[model samples]
Each structure stands twice: as structure tokens, then as C-alpha cells.
Target: MTLLDQPTGPSASVWPPDAHGPRRDPAPLLPDPEPFRMLGTPAADKLDPELLRDLYRRLVLGRRYNQQATTLTKQGRLAVYPASTGQEACQVAAAAVLRETDWLFPSYRDTLAVVSRGVRPVAALTLLRGNAHHGWDPKAHRTAPLCTPLATQAPHAVGLAHAARLRGDDVVALTMVGDGGTSEGDFHEALNFAGVLNAPVVFLVQNNGYAISVPLSKQSAAPTLAHKAVGYGISGRLVDGNDAAAVHSVLTEAVEHARSGRGPVLVEAVTYRLEAHTNADDATRYRTSDEVVAWRQRDPLAVLERHLREHDLIDDAGVAAAAEAAEELAAEMRAEFHSEPELDPMSLFEHVYAEPTPQLREQADLLAAELAAEADPR
Candidate 1:
């Protein structure tokens, strides 16, 4: 069977209330109308103005950086770029709630999330420049390397959470994946193990409706990805991924839940990929113009900007300053890239072993001698 053909159990029938007799009206394709799940008794009042503004800034920076990276790729400075243009809310909100002691496992598109956790901008550039396996030290920040293989990080996150529990630490591991990753065997295995072990972890699924060119409907038969947690007996929720405040609220709750030893939570943030899957893919061939237009109307940055303006937290001047600052930061980043050191050939062999083995040492010496001879030209 194909990926989409995976069994999702029985399907529920759709019928309007007050429908009498067998009326043959076609069911409209209605968007799910779940109420935005806010946290606390007085949800809106629970979050302070400062926290809200900070979230907005982080998300805005993420967007600006993504745009700059795309431009860099076009100019042939970066080898390849994966734009997370529309997924800022998911990255920022989730990263914001994570404690410094907690661990973060991110995918390649989650540079913003890593940055939020105190990883320097220059460190992130190391990976894009192909000079480092990962940008930051895992032990220092408790963050794993950005995994490019789909859903592979899920199991690693589970292992981390397990280790934390064994050590009697209160640390929780949070990892994110695209909607398409849920179909991977690693995703299910990780969830199952977390459930059985009662591990403190959060599985964040950014359901942007497509895995590359494939639509969500063609990827899975499930009505909603959140329901995947039902079999594992873990708490699950689906939130408006485009709503920054909503995303923050849900993640805060998830973090608290895991910290309190309530086991794990599966959060499905329903979002959309505004740009092509990457710089390489042509989304126009698979998705319709009308669909893309509709999603753009709900762009996360635009939605949050309107919210901030209406609430009197930010004004035109604040928006202008933020934009200007973002551009300046991007400019500094590009300059830094130009001055980055050349990759050391021997450095590759240096990190492979704690103490170099006899065979490896001999190979490194041989390579170094060849390099030295070439440079000397004697």
C-alpha cells in the first residue's frame, strides 16, 4: 500500500443537524472549526504584554532571516536553502516555551527555533556553509544537531527524554517534524516508546498540508493528524498554526504538562507552506493558485501584526524599527559569511575519534604530508 493508503480506521459520516429524510445535498468542504484552545482560566489576561511583544519580535526576525537566506541562495552564496517562510509561529512559540535545561531536537528548517534557544546566528551559519555537522554544542544547550532525514530525530528525542528521566532530571525533550513525517515508521515507533515509557517529551507536527508536492489529503487518510495520539493514550491537540498567540499558549501548556510528569503530548499545528517546498521544487505544478491565495490571507506574521496593532502594543513606528533592524542584522550576517574561514581538510579526521586510532592516525599523517608536499612544490 502507498503512504496515503495507510489504514486510519473508520471514517465518520458528515450530516448537518436538522436534516430530515435523505436529502441529496453535497457536503461542502468545510474547514475544521475547533475553538482556539487558550490556556488558564483567564487565558487572554494570563500572558503579559511584554511576553507577547517578545514573541512577535522573534517571529518577525525569523521571517526576515528566511527571506535573506533565500536571496543569498539565489546569489550563489549558500549551496542550498530551505525556506521556513510561513512556519515562524510554530518555531518561535515552541522554542520560547522551552526551558534552558530542556532539550530541543529540530529539523533542517528549524534554524529559527535553534536561534531562539540562544544559539548564535554565526553558529547557525556554520551548518549552511557546510563547515560543521551542527551549529551549536549539544551538551551546552541540550539541543541535538538539526536532523535532515525526515522523522529520524523523533527517536533521538525519545532517547534523550528517557536518559533525563533515568538521571532524575526534570528536563523534557521537544522535537518537531512536518506532517509528511508522521507517515514514517520512526515517527510511530518514537510515539509508541514514549507512551509506554511515559517519557516527558512533546511531539510537534507542523502540518503545512503538503510533503513536498504531495497534499495532506494525499499523504494521510486521517481527518486530523492530532488523532494519531489516541492509540498511544497521550493528550493531543490541534491549534491554528498561523496564530502566534495561539501557538504560544498551546506550547506553554504542553511544556508544563511534560514538566509535571503527565507523560507526552502530541500537538498538530495546522499551517501552510506559502513558498515552494524548497528553492528547488515547483509548487505551482501540484497546488492551485486559489488555494495558495487563501492561505496567504491567513499569513502568521500578518495576523500577529494586526493583533498587536489592535491591542495598542505596537504602532507604525515599532513596525518600522523592527523591519529596519531585521535588515541590518541580515546585512551583518552576509558580511560574516564572506569572512568565514576556509574548511580545514585535516579537521574532518580530527573529530571522528576521541583519541586517534593507529590506522586513522596513519591516514591523517599521509594526507597531511601530501598537502604539505603540494604547498611546497619542491
Candidate 2:
């Protein structure tokens, strides 16, 4: 049989059905691979209309927030910022399925996910503005601080899951990392430990293809990153990351699995990064324009918005209103950042340790004296 007409079954032999003679060529590896199964398929039609509308609003807000943050950084308001322009679907969908009781360990680019989960916009900005050690307390909201060091949050999530298991808390830890981060040793270590300990955690890897200019092909030789979990002896899934509904469904299943004490699962979200790595990095330097154009067609916000409109959950006017409201909120947040009190350099040592060291005390005193000396003596 021709390659196009080859039987897709376990019984089908690598030799063609009509091959009456000895095989002239070596068989190709992995001919009839199992079809990629998506989680949450059965639940698509069961989503509430109100939740769909809320998802749309959150998507728009996330897009607007990233845009404004980029503009602000360019205008000298922020030190540096990461943009989650094209990955809203993964963030929003996964966030929507989470309970407030669930724990979240997010990277810096996951501001959209945090915001969707009720993190105040201004509070998130506090980290970017160098005003707070962390955006919010993890114990208070069950969300960890934004991890700037790549892939470091994965193991932290594992620790949280271990703690929850010990305390007999029915909470799951959902940790997110980029496709590029999967190369880090921390990522592998976390996955292994979670599997061995049967930790209640979900590893969500947003595979946007390029890890700061290094393409996914260079990052791994595995056919699919989700397959990495097989070595760790855990469940793994690969999903269409651009489809918010699909993401939501898969994450809901994963969360349920963890809550039911099924151990850990790894989800590889096959998506793309639409914008540059940051406002600073130039995508044109490495990626082709054709690639950007192709991924642009799969924009998650546009896909979800279309889905909502077709379902009649929202109208054009409703979308417009959401955008307007998001703009107002962004403006208010910007104003709040501007009005924040100046950082006290002396206060930097205040929370460094449980008890202050003599050297730290002396440094603090020196800083206070310098500030006092610099004050106007009118």
C-alpha cells in the first residue's frame, strides 16, 4: 500500500500489504504512532456562557495590559518587562480551572495568568517597579512570587505539593515554565522528584518554540516534549495551546487528577511566541517573517473572541466595552505606580534576614547618615 493509504493499526505490518517479494528497503521507525489525544474534549459543550464571556474579557485585558506595559517601559516607566502577547489562551484557560485554594508558581511572563486569577494589576506591577520583594504573599493567595530566574519555580512547586501532601491539604500546585526552560536541570529534577514522591502538581510547559532565539528543535531531540514524562513514569499530554477552550479543558482534567491523588502530570502546550522575547529582543534577527505571519493567524485572543461571538455570549459592543474598561484600569494602575513612595535604600537590609547582623546594621546606619547629609539644609 502507498504511504497515504497505509493501514493505521497495530496489526498492520511495516511491509506493504501488496508486498509479495522480499522487502527492498529498511522500515521507517514509528510508522503508525498513536494519535495525539487532547484532554477536556468531552467538556467543550458544557462550559457556562458567563464563564465564556469572562474568559473573553480576561483575554482582552491581558492583551491590553501587556501592550500598555511595553509602552510604559519604552517611555521609561518600568525597568524591564516581559510580554505575553500571544500566549493568553494558555494562561487564561489554565487559570480559569484553578480554585483559589490551589497553589500557583508562575514565571515573570505569567502576569496574565496571575491577573486572571485575581492578582491586582497594581500589585503585579510592584515587582516590575522595584517597589516590593514579591508581588504578593503566596500563603495569602496561594500564588508564589514571580520567578525571574528561569525554571527555578518548577521545583518550588514540587515542594509546595509535598508540603500539601504532608498537611493532608487537598490542594494541587500548578507550575508554569517556557519550552526553553525545559532544558534546565531544574525542570528535569522537579519532574523526577514529583513523580517519585507522587506530589500533587501539574507541570505546564508553554512550548512557544523559541527559547530566546534557540528554537525548540535545538532544545530537545525528543519527538514531543510531553513524552519526557514517560521516562519519569507519569502521565503526559500535548495540547493545542492556542485554543483557550482546549487548554481549559485539559488543565481541568489535570487538576482533577492531582486532587484525586493521581500523582503529577506534564502538559506540553504547543504554541508560538508572537512578540519578541521582550521589548528588548528583536525576533527578526532570528525568526523568519513567514513564521510570525503563520503564528499570527493562530492568535489566541482572536480565536477565543471568535468562539465567544459565534456562541452569542458576547457582541461587538460588549467587546468594545471590555476594551474600554481595561484601558481605564491600565490608566489607573499607571497613575498608582507614579504616586508610589520613593524606595528607601536603607530599607533594603530590613528583610534580608530573620535577625539583623552587626555588619548589616552598620551598613544601614551608613546609608541613613548619607541620606541625611544629602538633604537640603534650608
Candidate 3:
């Protein structure tokens, strides 16, 4: 069977299938490997109008967010930013698939996902701006701090999912990571525990060709990243990450599979990073401009916008409206970041423990006294 003919979810009896089905001759691994595509296809005609419009709006907004965040880093407002320029679909789909009670464990690069899930745009950039406190609280947002350590959030998501299941709560935890993170020991251990405990968790591996300067070819010898799931005895699914409709469809199925108490799921979203790893890294040093230009042809926003227009799901006015909304958000973020934040000197001692020790109390007193003396020095 052809790659497009392969089943898109765990419902297929084959359980796990090679992205290329079964090829008799040795086949060169295609980076995309005929990923399950929906937009620009017949399947797109079946999508709900509401869903299409929502995806369209988010796609436009996500791209704008990435662009603006990268600009902030250039202006020195943000210490650094890992833009999701070409990977908006994965971010939007992952956020759209979860329930409100669910939790999201995002790697540092997933600011788009966090913002798409109702997080305030400026608050989402706090960590990247090198702020002392994450602008948003974890419990209030149901999101974890943007994790900088590679693959560490994997085990945290599993522990939360397993504990929620044991507490009789219908909660699912979804975590995201880049292609390089798969090589980390934490990733394997988390998947192992998630499979054994049947935790209600979903892993979205955005295989965007490279893990910083390192390419996937150097990270693993596996045929496909999705294939990693079989070793842990879980279901695996693949989709064209740039195709927002396909991404939304696949992620929804995976999340439901976990939520229904079936088992954990691993979804590999084959995509590309249109920009460098971060503002600090130079992508041209490693990759050619021509390669980036080719990926630009499949930009997620354009794909979804075209589908929405063809299906009569969104009109020109709707498109303009989405762009206007995104622009407004970008402006607001710029205005907010231009102002200096009031940092309390005492916050360093807070949240470290439920109660402060005598040593800590003594230090707090000394710090307060110093502040008081400065204020009265005239």
C-alpha cells in the first residue's frame, strides 16, 4: 500500500506500521515519508466549519507570535527565543486536543502552545525574558514552567498522569519535545513508566529535522521516531505537521485514546524549523537557504488559510480579521514588555518552603533592614 493509504490512528489492526508501509527494495528514508495529509486533500472537505475556522485563526496567530517573539530577542527584550515559525500546526493541535482539566508540560520552545491554550501573551514570554518569576502561576494556568532542560519534563508529565489516574480523575497530561530530546535518558524512562502504568499521557515529538545543530540522522537509527513507541508497548501515529487539519485530527485521536484508559500514545509530527534554533544560533552555518525556502512553500498558516477559503469555512474578511487580531496581540506584547517590572527583593525567600527556617528568617530581616535604611537615608 502507498504511504497515503496507511491508517492514521491506533484503530488499525496492524497496531504499528512503517511510514512507507512495506517496500521490498531498500528505500531511502524520506524526511516526511508520505505523512498522513488532510488539507489540500479530500479528507479536508469533511472537517467541521467551526473547527476549521478555529484552526485558521490559531495558525495565523501562532505564526505572528513566533515572529514577534523572535523580534523581541533581536531588540533585547527577550534574552532568547526559539521560534516555532514552521511548526505552528503542531503547537496549535496539541493545545486544541486537551481538556481543561488536562495538563501541558512544554519544553522551552513551546511558548506557542502555552499561549494558544489561553495563556496571556506577555506572561508566556517571562521565562524567555529572564524574569525571576514566571508571569503566570502553574495552578492557575494548568501549565508547567517552560522547561529548558532537555526531556526532563517527560517524567514529570508521566508522574502527574499516573497520579491523576490513581486519584480517579479523568486527567491526561501531554508533553512536547524536539527531535534531539528523544536521545535523553529521561525520555526513555518516562515512556517506559508511562507504558507500564498505562498512564493517560500523550507525547508529541515535533521532529523538525534537527535538534539544534544536530540532525535526526545523528540522533537515532530508527526508521521513524514514531517507531520508538513499539519498544515501550504503546500506540504510535504520524502526520504531516504542516497540515494543520491532519495534525488536529491525529492529536485529537491520540488524546482520546489516552483519556479513554486505553494506553499512552506517541505521535511524531514531521515538520521543519523555518528559522534557526534561536536568535543566538545561526542556521545558515549548518543549512542552506534553499532548503529553508523549500519548507516555506508548506507554511502551516497558508495551508490552513487556503483550506478554509476553499471549503467556504472562512472568507477574506475572516482572514483579515485573524491577521488584525494577531497584530493587536503583538502590539500589546511590545507595549507590556517596554515597561519595567516591579521585582520584590523578598520574593527570593518565598515559595522555597511552606515555612521559613530561622536562618532564612534572619536573612529576610537583614534584607528588609537594608532596604529600610536606604529609603530613610535622604
Candidate 4:
């Protein structure tokens, strides 16, 4: 029996008005008691060998990309980078399950996910490099620009999904956000809209233990970030983000659920970022090295590699091939960043509006005159 079925006394009235309206059983909507895992468990043995090997290859590539991007930041080639050094499983699995027609809405830290979805690595980092508003054409790939603002992309995903539903298009929009972004109004609003509209949307919350330096405990009192779905009336899932097999399985299920018109789903992936929030932040100030060391034992790449090796799904040759491919990608990234990007000063104003406003026109003219003077020098 539910809590509504039990009353204290005659003083207890019909508490929730269940008799007056329809009610949903919240049990089916709640997340698993613990994060769903497959790696390090007997279940890992049954995963497709081919699939596991593919995931391993992508994880290796993603890790190398993270390292190379971080190196660029140190060398002053890239302006800033939010390295997904430890979250390769989440990114690769997410990309693996997405269809070409499906839309991806990613946050700043999800540049790796974008690249995995066919956006060129150099193009994906354009925003981080301060080179362009969007490095690649978002429309061509059905991926939105990597949003830097917290939780803002959630509503965009909801709107697009709802519109697709109305148009009878088979599209599922997946928006990935941090655990901290759960507190934002845009996140809540998107959840509410998705619930009411039954939009084909999935929310992937990569709970990497912190919102910047603030730990998850200090951020919210929810039993788990996945529980955030209950209040919004969508299904919730919890997954071991470090387990490539687990993340891929859970996301695949959730995306299919949404695409099938069951409404949106919320999935919280429990993981950690081995690196600081970014190159600019000091993670050590709030977190201890011991804690980091403990988490490193469950590193996504390492966990997947161990499972693959133990099952004989991948051998020395496979490992060597993956590493060599990663090195080539890293080398290409280094070559790409070697020269300065050719930026047009006036081009910034081009996309602001169809017809430039008077103020915008004035500003563009001023910038143009400045450029002319710089080119001529009297």
C-alpha cells in the first residue's frame, strides 16, 4: 500500500485527492537503489566482444584527445579546456548510441562527445579556442553548439523534441549537463515542459562529484541526482559512468524509451573527473589527492580495458592498434593548433540579425574603420 492509503486517524483527510484525479505510482519512476554497473561484475562477460573492442578504441582516442587538449592549454595554443580525462566512457557510449537523425545538446565539457558524433576535433574546439561561435555546422550533424552556460541547453532540447513530436519526426534529443546544473531554473523548467508535453528528450547528468570545487553533498539534498526525475514525472536511471558497458546499455535503453514516445527520461551517471574543473581552477583546494587516487582506481578507460583483456575480447595487438590510432589523432590535433586561426573581426556581426540594427551597424562600421586603419597605417 502507498502512503496515501494509510491514514493516521479521522483527522486525516483524503490527503492527495487521489479519488478526484489520476495518480502515478512513483516506484516505477525512481532510479535504481545503486548505480547500475556491469564492469567488474559477472555481467560484463556477456557483452558483445566486437562492441567492447569498439568502445575501447573510442575510449583510448577520447582520453588522448583530452590529454592533447589540456597540453594545448599549457602551451597557450588553446584558450581553455574542460578535460574529460576520466569521463571518456560517458562521452563515447553516448555517441555510440545516438542515431544520425537524433539531436545532441551538450554543455561546454561535452566537446569530446561532439567530436565523437562526427564533428571534427579542431572544429569542436573552436569555441574553446575563441576562434568562432561554432566551429562546425550544427545543422549538418544534428548537434547543437556546445553550450557554455549552465543548464540553458535543457530547454532548447525540450522545445526541439516537442516540435519534432508534433511534426511526427522520429527524433530524440539528448542533453547532457553537470550535477550542479540540476539546481538551475532552466533545468527544472525543461523537466516540467518535457513531462507535460511528453517530449522525446533524455537528460544525461554526469555527476562527476562536483560543481566546480563544491562537492555534490553541498549542492543538493536529493537522495540521488536521478531522483530529480520523479518530481517531473519521467523515468529515472542511475548508471556506473566509469563502466563503458554500463553507460552504453543504460543510455541506449533511455534513448529508445524516449524515441518510442514514452516521454523524456533522466539518467544520472555516477563518475569523477580526475582533472581539475578546468586548467584555470585549483581542484586540490577542496578535494584531497587521496580521494582522487581512490577514484583513479576505477578509471573508466582502465576498467573497460581490464574487462576486455580478462575476457580475451582484446589482445596485445588490439591494444597496440588503439594506442597507435590515438597517437595519430593527437599528432593531428597538435598540427592543427600550430598556426593561428584566421579570424575576421567584422564577421562577428554577420549572424546577429538578418538586418543589422542601427547600433549594430554603427559598431560594425567602427570595427571596419579600425581594421582599415590597421591595414594602411597612414
Best by lDDT: 4
**Candidate 1 lDDT for residue 67:** 85
Residue 181, model 3, lDDT: 95
Estimate the lDDT of model 3: 0.87
Candidate 3 vs 4: which has more TM-score: 4
RMSD for all candidates, in order, please. 8.9, 8.8, 8.1, 3.0
TM-score winner between 2 and 4, please give it: 4
Q: What is the lDDT of residue 245 in candidate 2?
A: 69
What's the lDDT of the predicted structure labeled candidate 1? 0.81
Instruction: Return the clash pairs for model 2, or none.
Output: none
Better of 3 and 4 by lDDT: 4
* Steric collisions counted per model: 0, 0, 0, 0
Decide which is better by lDDT, 2 or 3: 3
lDDT of 1 by residue, 193-240 (tens): 988898999999999989988888888887788878866767777888
What TM-score does prediction 3 earn?
0.85
TM-scores, all candidates, are 0.84, 0.83, 0.85, 0.94
Least well predicted 10-residue stretch by lDDT in candidate 3: 23-32
lDDT of 3 by residue, 1-378 (tens): 997798865476453356545422212112244678988778877878898888888888888888888888888999989999999999999999888899999999999999977899789988788766576887777898888999999999999999999999989999998999999999999999998899999999999999999989999999899888878878877789999889999889889999999899888999999999998898988889999999999988887787777767888799899999999988988888888788888887887669999999999999999999998996
Q: Using TM-score as the measure, name the better of candidate 2 and candidate 3.
A: 3
lDDT of 4: 0.92
The candidate that achieves the highest TM-score relative to the unseen native structure = 4
